[model samples]
Target: MRTVIHKLFFVWDFDKEEKWLCDMAAKGFTLVSVGFCRYEFEKCDPGEYGVRLQLLNHRLHHPESQHYLSFLEETGAEHVGSFLSWIYLRKRTSEGAFELFSDFESRIKHLNRIILMVISIVAANLYIGIFNILMCFFYHNEANYLGFINLAIGLIGSVGIWKLLRKRKKLKNDKQIFE
Candidate 1:
């Protein structure tokens, strides 16, 4: 049997989302597909697979991304689904340990990708907000509300940017200390 779930997790909450997916896998539900705020899972043995989520540096269909995913698949991790630049992978527990990043440098690089994505979104949202507000002055009041909503979303993304930056900084510091 398959199960469908709807959950909301902000960009900054990716770690939390990963945890939830893993928890579900532990409960015999393994992810099969993903969409905006939607997850579809199929039945599996409890604790049969380990899940890992990554924010890729390019779109899923990009050659670079396809090659990277192919490399991962060769390593025994199955690409289950993706949304935007994010991908979900699963490896059987019997394959020993399943980890996408084995070193600090790779982990830091992953964080950088996520930070870049969030920053881009924040910049776009801020630009849209400003443009909408300016256009509202020449048009109608209703559009001003859209501007405010965009600004609010940008503000939220700014918070995520801060958090991701801190995380990247910490990873860099750790790499320096251990290396």
Candidate 2:
């Protein structure tokens, strides 16, 4: 029975995901936090104590007396600071396939995709523009050097300009940009 319990502990541990933590809490499975060999007992509350958060395998180094809450991450007890409880879980998201990206990364990826697409189109057009400019200047003997300058500027400014314009177009637009 003891061996099974220990194995179960390892299997149940998950990163500090809200949905999983919330579900575990709803299931009445209290997290037991124990200090390592050299460490000393800190506090009864997971909030007040500096215990480890949930690991990938659900089994943390829980020892004996500690506060376990239902909602927030399994790290500590209840507190206002728990708002960032989603941090650890989100941090792990990048390592796994079906995990949520952080707000900043999500935004950056979305913006990057849009920028890349626009740049690709503009780059093709820039090549076309350059071709036209060459034909006019060399073939027709109408030296328009300013045409190359404009093409350079367009390529450099493509990303920054599009991001600013599309960011606030609509609430749904931002979501759509990422997909």
Write the residue-wise lDDT of candidate 2 on 66-148 in tens digits.
12233333422332111111112211122332233345555445444444545665677577668868887779957776667
lDDT of each: 0.90, 0.38
**Candidate 2, TM-score vs. the true structure?**
0.27
TM-score of each: 0.92, 0.27
Residue 7, model 2, lDDT: 16
Q: Can you tell me which runs of candidate 2 are displaced by over 4 Å?
A: 1-102, 141-179
Q: Evaluate residue 62 in candidate 1 and report its C-alpha lDDT on the 0 to 100 scale.
A: 97
Worst 10 residues of 2 by lDDT: 1-10
Model 1 residue pairs with clashes: none
Question: What are the clash counts of all predictions, listed in order?
Answer: 0, 13
Q: Each candidate: RMSD to true structure?
A: 1.8, 18.4
